[model samples]
Target: MLNEEIPDVPYHVNGVEYERGYYLADGIYPTWASFVKGFSCAVDKKRSYFTRKQAGARKDIERTFGILQGRWHILQQPARGYEVNQMRRLMYTCIIIHNIIIEDIGYNLAENDWVVEPVVRMQRTWIDRCDTRKRRTKELRDSEVHEGLR
Candidate 1:
């Protein structure tokens, strides 16, 4: 799980620059730039299409995590006692095992072939973390960007 902290990094979406990352959420979530929600009623064709796609994507994510949780009961429970590093390792191990099982069952072998690549770690240098956070908060709550995304 994420801490829901937005990094002060700029990203591009359809040639537009956005300062904060967004999450796919339901209509129940607040109207913040960080939350990209689909239309509840979807009266128009575009809105209906968007709603279907968004709902499908969300369902896919939920199903994937549900399978992982069902397979690894540890993932089903809260990770309060475990450290961040431990949680990471546990999640990675479960994913790897899940992948192996999927391979053994011959599930989507052509589309989901295992590709081993070297991991590259990048180091971040922050001058003033607090100042960056303040700016990020404002960017995340920008209603203009939220409407534009919608």
Candidate 2:
């Protein structure tokens, strides 16, 4: 899993070049240079701040999973389907139904009587490939970015 080579999506960050995305993982995962992990034991104010922020972000993901499981009880327990296709279909169906329900009721907001328009962003339609040297450079740049993020 650590060595998996995903397709590159080039993007600029603070004038630094990066070619791929990364995943947020816990300390148990290997330091593959692609996975960003929070400091296990923060000793200083800066480290503590980063750890707190990372924990909050992780908790948000956990809460989202909890909500999904609650809404679709099928996700609460291990999937009984033996085939990958069966599991995929089941999850896709649940997500479509969830979206329809959400669209019908709309998202509840703190301002009960007001509805805000959703923001629109540009969509990319093309993907480009990078050579070996470029990929290696990107991996190093990504590692620097990961450290800076921490």
Candidate 3:
């Protein structure tokens, strides 16, 4: 995904405009513009809040994958010999079954009770095909932008 051409699209957050998208990462990942990692030693209340929130989000994702793995033995083991499409279908099937179970067990919440977040979908106007791989790599690994975003 990093090697591909980035689209000339922009996203706004807190009134700030960003043309590049980023991933929610952990401390182990590199300090790059594309990776939004939490501070290890937060000194201020704002940093503490951000760190807590990031940890919570990561934990939620881990818990979900853990639940899926526990319920589906196929997911617990390596997906050997399965094609990409097959693996995708398997994951979807597991999720659908899991949702069904949630509804059956009265764990599912009503539509009105659910908190729906707005998704930011950026429209790509053009791709920078002229940019070389090295240039793109440098842009992605820019630590200055990473610190600013953090």
Candidate 4:
């Protein structure tokens, strides 16, 4: 799944336009433009701070998965569903139930403060498909953005 490439969705950070979204990955993953990995050894204060923040964010995700697995034992064990769609629905249902439980218990931190934006679906035209050369160019641009982020 990690090896698969997804459609490009442009977004900006600090006035810089990134051609695609990225994932928070570990050192073991390849230094691809889409995977933001922390420094293995931090020599400067800036690097150290960034590394710490990245690790904390990763930990939060790990903790969330742990909680989900604990609450839904079916996720922890081998999926018993015969079809992939069935398994997907089961997981989705579990997540929705978890969110409902959190809301019911008044544990939602962004209940009133967070604004839900309607998702805008982009039209896929022939121009959106990138050839080998264009793909490499985009990859280079993405690599630059990744470095700037670091």
Candidate 5:
């Protein structure tokens, strides 16, 4: 899922940058620059340790969505007799019940969640890291030799 953001991923971070539509549609972490940088910070053990941790904990929501699709195949089909409003209510109720079951199984997310701070203060950190990353791009030259070998 790492390169799922792009149709074709380049050897560098500047490659395969998504347009505004993809960012707007995705809804979570709206920018490719920010998204990649956050993961890179988590990769480098610099800052936002808690943020990265929170992101991981949030993966359960994704799993929950996947489970809903797998367990109830009706979601894909059209409404035959049920009202759309009632169907949404039923889905919400099921989600709530699922959360209860998850809680009962000793799987509390609050304790495990680590919230990363916003980048208001991390601008310098971001620039510095990006510089380091740019310097490290030299390693890619060996993989697939490009023309701009300055």
Candidate 6:
């Protein structure tokens, strides 16, 4: 998705046409799909292979998990003491934080940037927090991992 890709309209995937949406980079811009569950309008495939491929392609899930897991506080007790709104805030802030890190270093290692900041911040603001720092750390770690930290 280029910056010009949006008002993006409908586009074809495998000759199957569907509405295409923009994803904000680094906690800014309006993005499509709420950052909660069901962030897409595609038909759900229940197969493990499909899920893996999709997850792998999207890769945000992995990056988010990596960011969250990197922060022991977030990893251990993400929302244990937070209010409903605060919890929402925490989750999204973490997401934005997580996404920024990914964007900074993703290209040299991964295929695409999945964590859009507006979406991340929207989730954070709607919920109420931002892990801009945590996500950045994860990005560095990922870079190291790419260099064989694993």
Winning candidate number (lDDT) = 3
* Per-residue alpha-carbon lDDT of candidate 5 for residues 62-130, written as tens digits (9 for 90 to 100): 667667767765355555667978797867766776777789998886677545444242345767767
> How do the residues 70-123 of candidate 6 rate in per-residue lDDT, one tens digit apiece?
873574664566788887777777867765775787533245434333422233
Q: After superposition, how far is residue 44 of candidate 1 from its true place, in Å?
A: 0.8
Question: What lDDT tens digits, residue by residue, belong to model 4 across residues 41-116?
Answer: 9999989999999989988767766787887664776776448888878767866776787789889855555343
Error of 2 at 76 (Å): 2.6
As a whole number from 0 to 100, the lDDT of residue 85 in candidate 3 is 91
The 10-residue segment with the lowest total lDDT in model 6:
29-38
Q: Global CA lDDT of candidate 6, please?
A: 0.44
Q: How many clashes in each candidate?
A: 0, 0, 0, 0, 1, 10
lDDT of each: 0.73, 0.63, 0.76, 0.70, 0.46, 0.44
User: TM-scores, in order shown?
Assistant: 0.64, 0.53, 0.62, 0.62, 0.33, 0.33
* Selected candidate, larger TM-score, 2 vs 6: 2
Query: Candidate 5 — which pairs collide?
Result: 51-116
Query: Residue 81 in model 4: shift from native, Å?
Result: 9.5
- C-alpha RMSD values across all candidates: 5.1, 8.3, 6.1, 5.2, 15.6, 16.0
State the lDDT of candidate 1 residue by residue for 1-150, as single tens digits.
022232344678768886556788888888879888898888999989988998888887678778878866657667897899999898788777777877798786657464545434344445555555677677667777877777
State the number of backbone clashes in model 4.
0
Using alpha carbons, what is the TM-score of model 2?
Answer: 0.53
Error of 3 at 88 (Å): 5.7
- Which ranges in model 4 have alpha carbons more than 4 Å from their true place? 1-11, 77-98, 101-142
Candidate 2 per-residue C-alpha lDDT over 1-150 given as tens digits, one digit per residue, 9 for 90 to 100: 122333555667557766656667778765545676789889999788978887788887677557777876656657764477878787677666655666688864335543434434344333322344456655644555677545
What is the Cα-based lDDT of residue 86 in candidate 2?
79
Candidate 3 per-residue lDDT over residues 22-49, each given as its tens digit: 8878999999988989999999999999
lDDT: worst 10-residue window of model 4: 1-10
Residue 81 displacement (Å), model 6: 3.2
State which candidate, 2 or 4, has the greater TM-score: 4
The collision pairs in model 4 are: none
Best by TM-score: 1
How accurate locally is residue 80 in candidate 2, as Cα lDDT from 0 to 100? 65
